[model samples]
Target: MKKFKKLFAATVISLAMLVAAGCGDQPTNEDQGDADNGGGDEVVTETPGDVGDAEITLEFWNGFTGPDGEDIAKIIAEFNNLHEGEIAIRTQTMPWDNFYDQYRTVVTAGEAPDIAIMHLDSIAGYARYDLLTPLDDLAADIGLEDDDFIPEVWDAGVYEGHRYGIPLDVHPLTLFYNVDLLEAAGYSEPPTTYDELVEMSLAVQEATDGDAWGIAMPVFWPSNMIFYSSLMSHGGDSVSEDGLTPLYNTEIGYEALQKMVDLVYEHEVSPSDVQADGEVTLFRQGNSAFHINGIWMIAGFEQQDGLNFAAAPVPTFGDQEAVWAGSHNFVLPKQNDEDPERLEASMKFIQFVSENSLQWAKAGQVPATYSVLESDEFKALEHQYNASQQNFVFPPSTPFYGDAWGPTGPAVDEAMLGQLTPQEALERAAREGEENARDAAEN
Candidate 1:
């Protein structure tokens, strides 16, 4: 242990020297990114540090404040202790609802953590502000290849052909249905067809004879009403081909939403009382027939028993299939002064996390790095959902995504409350979403 401490101290010194050397050259926008992409240039080399020679601390923050947070904290503690004390990683948990505001304030004040897990959408501002380090150079040094990741999930790091974030995992919305409920109701398989799905729901309600609904999710959030989860299979997108107009005004989009309403108000198969935590709790307790949520809900699902459920890709309302997806990724937020040692260390940490991500995948996130996903252990995970998680889809992930969805969510909520007719609600939501997208584009 004493020797380990000595080596740790050496590594820290080496890292500091590397940082000092790194201060010399920071690449321009045109020079940095993955070569797998045609747009990036090589990053200059810096001095190497001995792992046991130095002492440096890094602050880390994330929004897993729920049960998932507890597990992540445990993983970090192990990482910190495993090192020779050369790398000291500290963690902070922020509530998901307000994390962005907190993150923005700190970063603007030049007091941001050495590393952080950020949403894929908000990084556009960070990139635009020139606040992050390019990971391509570091990736090349460590044999980190772009081909090692799911192209769709991996490309998330690239903005304007330059990569900013190192993706950790993707959490996509999936269909979580109660096993016993389906079995007892005389349904052996999940419905692949919409009409079959509705029929199965009615059967469950009739066979079980209770408040259990066919399906449930908050119907409000005008933009959410048109969320990507239910429409991906149909190749339906809420944005026009140019991404400058709202496409939800089309017959396809309205038809999709009308089906949702039918399941609720029309068929009376899905109860209205299930909202927010209520829906999750009911499903967790085996009180509901079906739930539409992301892989993150796996922990909560595990807490319940006699409650076998399976995850399937979202069904197609038209002729195709799709689902909503989000990624947890690492980015080097702008530093008051860029240091090479810190940058290299940050990259190393990211690589280490990616290599050891199986611990994370068990909690329900899809591995963003390909190595883990194709690893023997990952394949052996006892998860029934893995079979269907391969094809998660989200809307065009761009900086404008937040504005498009956030501002229009309230309009959707109002519509769910019956404050507007479908046409009126869709028109209003479309207008607001478009306006928000436009505002972001102009910036």
Candidate 2:
């Protein structure tokens, strides 16, 4: 039942301290291109209230433009109906591409919304800019103690020892296999070990006569996550414990990247130069037998016309088990005019959302609350349950964690595309990360 201690002021420290202190990675929230709703939309209630007609209208904003966005809208509707006229929330939903730009512009213009959704990784940058408010008081008021949320997720929202956000859900990378395809390949279950995964991939390739791939590998966002996951599984890390040195280019890193390269070239189970969308399409079209993607794909995949699929945890590929994960969090924007009532209402909304997070789970996320995760309802979600309870790994808690990917991402992309060797890619990424760390340390 630990509480977040308030910071006297926003702290700005070197990236080394940020990393050493355990700040998480920068999540790449992709645009699913579901709708182009760019402006604020108000959600109205249907039922009567328990808080009477002492009404409070709050503005909420989020970048949930995927299938998850629909779920969020539905949750907002339900919350409104339950609260009735007492609390009305006006919501603005948009794609992730411009979400931060619009949020920062509004906050800078002194028209900040009462509350907004944010990625845990981006909290440090926002807090550094003094664009977010510390939520320690509101968290306490709503009884959101440390034990209420997953430790990794809870700590991710803290920057320089001040809590700035409340996590809603964690999206982790998971394995999705086409049931029919697996059976066709003479396998009753998805691969549980790295060797087993490779064997299955090879079998699928042979069975399909090279017409179908054993797996799909994206060269962009998914690539970075998979590489990091692999690195972690090998008992290696991206940066040193002190956060001053890049470690991914070491022998262990080479091993991890080599494994990825082997999947494409050495084993010939994956397609080369496949973009993210192409990889997803291959899986959806039944051309790929297995896919490693975020849990967010569950809702969409379940709706595909004739695809029969099952989910599993990302297998233990190396000495350790690990999978890359990120979270969506609720944050309060910095405001020129502070209204205690509005803040209180916002906290209540967050608490209500946490309590009813099963609805959010319906959008293919791992609930942040242990209570929800341990529920029979959540356990019924096969993929999410396993991923949440298994070796889910978050990026190192650091402001520089996100920026480190700038170089590492490209290096991995090159290796996947066969433009560089695995060792070359790891070495390059390490050099780039070291330069980034050096710059941050000096400044």
Model 2 clashing residue pairs (backbone):
22-397, 23-397, 23-398, 24-397
What is residue 438's positional error in candidate 1, in angstroms?
2.7
Instruction: Give candidate 2 regions above 4 Å deviation.
Output: 1-54, 240-245, 437-443
Give one digit per residue, the lDDT tens place, for model 1 in 1-443: 00100000000000000121111011111011111012112221111222243377677776665555555665665566665457766666655444555566677678877788766644554565566667777778877788777666676677676888888877665667888888989988777667877888888888787757666655532125234444444545556533456665656655665666567677777766556556666777777787766566666577666678777655555665455565677887777887787777767777778778888787667777667877778777645235334355533434454444443355545555556655676677678767866755664
Listed in order, each prediction's TM-score against the native is 0.81, 0.87
Return the top candidate by TM-score. 2
Q: Model 1, residue 44: displacement in angstroms?
A: 36
Tell me the spans in candidate 1 whose CA falls farther than 4 Å from its real position.
1-54, 220-226, 240-244, 387-390, 395-397
Compared with the true structure, all predictions reach lDDT values of 0.58, 0.73
Per-residue C-alpha lDDT of model 2 across residues 106-223, encoded as one tens digit per residue: 8878999898997765677678768899988789987998887888778778887889989998787789998888888899988887889889988888888888899988876567
Q: What's the TM for model 2?
A: 0.87
